[model samples]
Target: MDPVNLLFLVPAALLAGFVDAVAGGGGLVTVPALLATGIPPAQALATNKLQGSFGTLMSTWTFWKAGQIDIRSMLFPVVCVLVGAAAGTVAVQVIDASLISAVIPFLLVAIALYFLLSPRAGDLEAQARVSLPVFGLTVGIAVGFYDGFFGPGTGSFFAIGCVALLGMPMRKATANTKLLNFTSNVVSLAVFALGGQIIWWVGLAMAVGQVTGSFIGSHAALRFGAKLVRPLLVVVCLAMTVRLVANPQHPVYGWVSGLFSG
Candidate 1:
């Protein structure tokens, strides 16, 4: 990338890191920036994973240092995330992404609405509805697989699962989400790297920004609690849903366009 083009990405990556650390939606920013810079979709996805891994790592470290996450307790979930993400990454290389692309927007919309309407969704901690082993096997594997394959809204999904099933407060859920996000990201990054799909120069450049932004964002979450994080989560998910559906190649977009033309 040229100096000017590279400069354009730095601020976007920085902002993405911050937003992602808080409520998960950084790809809503960074992926578009990559595509705008003319990176092909596969390379863009791979490169985004590279920078995202850095941001998630920083966020996870910050949350851990603050005593928000229990790494030892999360080992099983982390292992599930690794296995699921590896499967997803490998599947994506062979499968037609359109298979799931059509459905994710609706799922994102549902998640946004759930948080929007539920007053207690993330505000207060409650009793866990299911055992940790069950949560790990189900939500962990499903969301981790989605993260590796489709690469958007993974954080929000994990956050909701933590809140609804694990009964963690918003802040704690966000913290734990980062840990899982980091795990899936690292696993996916390895797969992408092995396939030689990453744009190293661009990814590394963005990663520098991700580290700094995530640090600030994580601290912000620790300070503000649900008041700040909740709204951001809704906005990010809705925004990502719109971004995906607005693409003319997207099924929803195509359907809408066809209706209008007809």
Candidate 2:
């Protein structure tokens, strides 16, 4: 790749890491930057997973060190996510993704509305609505599958599940989200690696930026807690929704075009 591409991608990766650490949707930045560099879409997505792993790992470590994550409690959910992501990855090879793509923007909008309008969305922990085991089997697996199948809004889904079902505070939810996100990311990365889709040099170079930005962003999250996480989550979810719908080939775009033309 040209050095000029690195100039664009590295900075984008840095910003992506920062935003992703705070909330999610880092791929919103990095994927486009990679595509703009003229890499194949497969390589761009694979390379994103490579760099994203670094960012998620860094943020997870930071959260763990701060005592925000409970690894022992999270073990089952991690395993569940592993299974779900693996299944989803395999399923994607055969299934049509258009239906899922059509539905996602609406779901994202609902999530954004929930976060924006719900008074207690991320304010504080309430009584747990479900046990961790149940949460693992349901939200964990579902979101993991979604991540592997569609590859967007995953962190938002995880964070909301933690906050709403598990009754975790915003900071704690964000911490746990990173851990689970890392698990799913690694599963996808391995598949991509097996297919030899990644560009190593680009991924490694962006990883440097990912690590640095994640470190800073995680610290910022710790310091500000819910105040920072809440608004950022809303913004990230809505932005991702827009990006999805804006794609000309996206199902939502086609549906809208048909509506207007008819």
Model 1 compared with the native: what TM-score?
0.96
How many backbone collisions does model 1 have? 0
Clash tally, candidates in order: 0, 0
Question: Cα lDDT of all candidates, in order?
Answer: 0.91, 0.93
- Tens-place lDDT per residue, model 2, 1-262, is 8977898899899999999999999999999999998999999999999999999999999999999998998999999999999989999999999999899899888888888888677778789999998999999899899889988999999998999899998989999999999999999999999999999999999999998889999999999988999889999999999999999999889989999999
> Which candidate wins on TM-score?
2
- The TM-scores, one per candidate, come to 0.96, 0.98
Task: For candidate 1, write residues 189-255 as lDDT tens digits.
Answer: 8888998999998999999898999999999999998998999999999999999999888999998
Error of 1 at 64 (Å): 0.3
Q: Any runs in candidate 1 off by more than 4 Å, and if so which?
A: none
